[model samples]
Target chain A: MAGRRVIPGFGLSLGFTLFYLGLLVLLPLAALVVKASSLGFAGFAQVLGSPQVQAALRVSFVSAAIAALGNGLFGLLLAWVLVRYRFIGRRAIDALVDLPFALPTAVAGIALATLYAPQGWIGQWFARADIQIAYTRAGIVVALTFVGLPFVVRTLQPVLLDLDAEVEQAARSLGASRWQTFSRVILPALVPALITGMTLAFARAAGEYGSVVFIAGNMPGQTEIAPLVIMTRLEQFDYAGATAVGAAMLAVSLLLLLAVNLLQAWTRRKLGGA
Target chain B: MAFHRILRSFTALALITAALLTQIAGCSSKDGDTAQPGTSLTLLNVSYDPTRELYKEVNAAFADDYRRKTGIDVRIEQSHGGSGKQARSVIDGLQADVVSLALGYDIDQIAAKASLLPADWQCRLPCNSSPFTSTIVMLVRKGNPRAIRDWGDLTRQGVSVITPNPKTSGGARWNYLAAWAFAQRNGRDPREFLAALYANVAVLDLGARGSTTTFVQRNIGDVLLTWENEAYLALKEFGADRFEVVVPSISVLCETPVAVVDTVAMRHGTRNAAEAYLQFLYTPQAQDIAARHGFRPRDASVAARYADKFAPLVLVGIDSFGGWPQAQARHFAQGGLFDQLYGGR
Candidate 1:
């Protein structure tokens, strides 16, 4: 009786879910793996061993990590402000969070490049301090942050809104300080949603190409990202090498995402046990 | 009640899936139908960036001439991007009727990968399939602040240079080769000189126009190594008061090649219009338009008319480096000199 389903079509629903997932996601990904394998093991090794490819991979992963971490923190704050507060223009602020999602990435890239160029308004200030932002690694992270922000915010907003304020209020009444209430009470409850948001942001940033290309100066081994390296190989008509790099990116991203999912599941289990 | 709700959702989901499947089937069937040419002909001209303005004028003139010659109305659709990227699109089935790219090698890729044209496609047109030619030159900041004069000056310690990546940009390959040609003619090691020159490049854009924007709009570099026509366009678009074009001592004659995609042309039945369109480029009227747009005209008389606009510099042709095939293999190929030099991060 405890495991009985509410609706009686579980078998039908499960079949539909598996069929849709297999057709839409699994098939395309299997095709990618098949194409990559056609390159042969030695060919894959050669592509992965190139310094340019290695540097590009490093830049893509590191910048994506930094950008996702940044989004996770700021996105939580933004969601909290939107859901917990009743400030003027709060609705407008809430809507603004989704702008990055709606705006074309290429347009966002151009706008960011303009705002951060040495001669631009914001860039003028940086230039005065002898610091460069556009066309550097920092610029790549900024572009990634711009594109990945909405993923984190949109993912966490509903969970934050669903969080009952009474829990915090009760903790406070029980003589728990504000810091303790947030760190112990609120944070644990938010962990699963936060991890979900961060993983989504990280995955989006890792595959981002249009926005990063405009701001990333594209200096080989210095600012070039992995997707751009793949594009370069494709342009050179090295289809096998391009597939090899793509497969490597896919493998790393899959592993990272799997690890995050495991962590999320573990946290959920711990919370349920608690 | 719960069972009813689940049944309702399942019905809705099934409807959506059926609709999506039907839509997919419709799209696939539509694509399988072959395109037919009608009385009014439409040609897709896939060109590289920086040729947008030039092609606009050329297309307009060609359309008028074709209409007057044959009672058929011609409409040309233009698509532009980085040279190699444009070629890749053609290879990936963009169905371009004619491809006027920045380099012969890009067209060769389309020929080899898609069988869009024959191996000796260049022999189909006059002037080795190049309608017009330009050379690499410097667009410097106002007052020549860097005091940059030639290819050697570009390698100076403090001058920040802006040029596109040679691997993706056909214009950049010419820019790189022009400098290499200069160094070689002066008894300097081409490799070492190129290394020094690249060391001063502040930003390597993916295409010619991107580098132009970097230099002219962003003002990030001291000198921009770009095609002569691009430099002219920059000076004309952005105030000439803010920038100056400096002709280097020696440069490469960059031939802009054109080819009709035989497969697409044959399939669409626009082969006659496509061939005529390319043939029209060799006309004196078309050469005049090319000269007006800063491209060095192949016709001597049309070139002479624009002699004052162009500076006389020692120009080395691509043939000097064993043509596009050999040059592409030796320099821009994967793990070649370009990769070896900049591969290290």
Candidate 2:
């Protein structure tokens, strides 16, 4: 605490922190709210009321939720395995986890398109098996999962690594089974991190465009997601329409993820007490 | 060693940050430059793919002669993407002074939003403001195994044709319109033709270049409905023997429009240079160069220069269908015939 006196101190640090966050995040978001508000109530109702808009909202939310949920489950397992035990090429596997983050979205889209098109490698197999993926809603989910996995794994890795082992032992000593130790003792400690990871993954997947477009076939009201709808509006030079859709998406996405945030806060309160 | 290691890590981090910042900043400044009075005005022509060679030769000539006449620096910066996407970027405030996209409808979109163009913008310049025109043709593998002679051949089952999404790619619209126009001309219902043709499509790509790459480069599909210039470039690049260009008995005229982004022109005070740049595109020299790139020259006299290269055919204008606007509204526009076909399917 005394060392803080040598630094910028409490007042200046607090002011600088707020200023930085305001400039980087709040200012842009405020602009969106202001710009969107300019559409007025009647205009917004018309934009949101369109059947195409509703379809896009459904596709964006459902696909993003599916991808984030898939990531949370698999990412937890991958993070746990990496941390709890040793393995060959562990560093290489860890590096591979970050590939989606590093690869350009357009390049990823092109690669996914090539890999999943009807005549392409995996598509050939799927075609033979009579299970279609590319140019379908399933392709959108696959691309979203591919891009959002890194967020969950990276978030959960440290949480799992730092988890206290004695809690599990203590639970077992109380005659609790292994499943009980995991479910009751260890899982509570991980809830905040898991929820946070899921929220980030969902947000990332919701706005994703490039990777999905190639695989989606861009058929309106079919594989078209909300971002594609916005892109379509933009292409048509429908500025009001694009922003109208974007603002509606903003509201729905915030509402959809409110539960995860509340869960995170609850977990934080529990962890603080522990 | 410890000090060197720390220095190396800091240097690497700085380099990465610099690289990323440079890229972000490069896209940030759309176009903010003015030639001092009496200096050359550099014109940036951000175009779609395959214009690299065409623009290189045309810009060189424009710089020399424009400098000779007006002493302006005529620089053309052409970037290509799927046409509709490119037009969307332009509309989303890409600082393009002049846009020559793959279709006229995209230019009309810019005009609608920015009020940067006249109602008859395409006709503002010579030859309906296009200065050059292309036609859609079937790009088949060497020997043309599909034996596809016209648009009707594509409707046969299991054809596995490839085209870019019409909603996104300007070139793809021409492909869509050509098929639609042919169906209408042949007295077949547009929906019937469209449903069958779309069913034959195995893949939909981002733009003409992407679709062409899949067809010519990867050798994927039976027939690729592509821009004539792209087919020519493919033949020129990938040996003419490697692929065959099958001109459909009838095809839609792909007229690309060029225009100055007006507000940008007013702000930059490059109005004279911008207008001059567009007019220069129609000159015999430019038209001949366009013909070389497989675009039919706007000038009949200049087109004769490449007479040996062009195959004889009756060129049909959109005048038969009341030009582009009506054609677009009737065939491909939202709630148009496309939806009638795709919706039912």
Candidate 3:
């Protein structure tokens, strides 16, 4: 809480934030578990043990990991370009970077499917060239990449802006190479932001449904993702099956996110000490 | 302090820009699908989005005819989504006049969701009041490369099957029903056959069209469980040489029903139009177009002309499963047996 109330009702606002988050996020998830409790142990196990559920878990988390890893490396490059350069239509390019964040997941999915199908605008070219990007493991990654990019870019943007150019200049003054200054100084400050971005991206990709559904081609063992599987359970009225898969996914992702956040905190502290 | 003000202003500007963009987008969508003006008769037809074009044409025809006969304006407002979602919407008081959904059971959910649609509503209507029906057909590679002639061939180890999530697509119910029937006819218990069948499924996308993308666009599956009209459309849209329809030995009848939402119509004061609109669904003109779209016309003679399109079957209607209510409770209802078989871990 603020020591002095510069703004009226700071505590109230914080309470409202917690209450809103609790109502919207925590309660629904809790209800999901509560509803799932009606299922006995055998019932729960039966729901989770199905081949389809197993396959979906693999697709959801693995693709999310692949997407996060891929985005982390590439999103950094993209952020650097945006921050360091003044290109023609630079503002327009900046606006376009947020398109994924703005567009509906459903519309994005449909557009990508149309673009990358075997006979789609771009897909036709890929087919002729013997490359495939739609409806395989590749398409899921592409979708994850689509929704995840803005997170990394937006996260790193301000940090990049706040970064002191003098540090790089001082390193160069000390006869340190360009690569050495980047690898040691700039990269460290950006680590916390990068990890935050990757966490956001990974979490988003893990639960992503609409865009992935259109492009994933929904192959059971291969292209099937966990969210779609949870949906299938919901449709079949298998609330327990949906929840079990969801809970499992949440646990795994939470562990991963914890590790990432801890790494980020460590990085931030190191940068602070320096 | 001055620099801090600029930074705060910069964030405020970005938030404003995002907010303005979302508002414009939101307002534009507000009336994107508004109903026609000055229609004394309002008919709410819960339906699929793909059928919007077809319904537009049919509604145009119906409006002309309905106006000529009644001397009053009539409009059909179509609500589209996954049929199950749509059904729940109506059940939860979407104020639907006549419910034309992807399946009988979805309409049945309106009755089941509350006391809104009666439990025995199916029995109350003749032939369950299902206006139109479809069957599942296989969309194969342009040349049928894998020679996936039937459902059995789909299980030939390496043959991957692509279908919409049966949970979302009412048509996928036909797809699942057909698969079960295929297994049952082949002397395998429906359960074992389903497990094996789902084993070959590679991608279980969320909707029918999405699954079609997997088949036609991605070329991932050996066979695709698709609607009859969609199969016909795919062949026509893609080169005829691009896809072939494989009729199974026994096909499941996908009955799409329409019923008057008595409660909603009474509230909206569209009862006459709503009731007439549902009655008009059985008209000869509607049947013709319904048949043209590869949907089996409920009318007799028209179905004969189109008989060749549909495979001969033992007529596995929802009646065989003790009607819509029982079938819903047994199979597709939440945690129903189908879930146990397919989704159960």
- TM-score leaderboard ranking: 1, 2, 3
lDDT, candidate 1, B100-185, per-residue tens: 99999999888888887998999989888998998999999899987999888988899899999997888999999999899999
Evaluate residue A104 in candidate 2 and report its C-alpha lDDT on the 0 to 100 scale: 96
Candidate 2: how many backbone clashes? 5
**On residues B1-345, what C-alpha lDDT tens digit does candidate 3 reach at each position?**
544776799999999999999997775444222223443455778886346655776787888887877676787888877777677667656777777777777766677655665666655555667777777788887677888777778778888888776777787777887887777778878877777887788777666776776678666678888888788777867777877888766777777777777777665666667666766667888888888877778899888888887667654665666765676667666556666765542
DockQ metric for all predictions? 0.54, 0.18, 0.35
lDDT of every model, 2 decimals: 0.90, 0.78, 0.77
Per model, how many backbone clashes are there?
Answer: 0, 5, 15
Ranking by lDDT: 1, 2, 3
Clashes of 3: 15
Q: Who is ahead in TM-score, 1 or 3?
A: 1
10 residues in a row with least lDDT, candidate 1 chain A: A1-10
Model 2 spans > 4 angstroms off: A1-27, A30-46, A49-51, A118-132, A169-178, A263-274, B1-39, B67-73, B82-93, B109-112, B117-124, B214-221, B237-242, B260-276, B325-334
The segments of candidate 3 whose C-alpha lies over 4 angstroms from its true place after superposition are: A1-58, A87-92, A114-133, A177-179, A238-260, B1-39, B141-149, B157-160, B186-202, B217-222, B235-244, B304-314, B321-344
TM-score of chain B of 2: 0.84
User: Which portions of model 1 miss their true places by more than 4 Å?
Assistant: A1-20, A271-274, B1-38
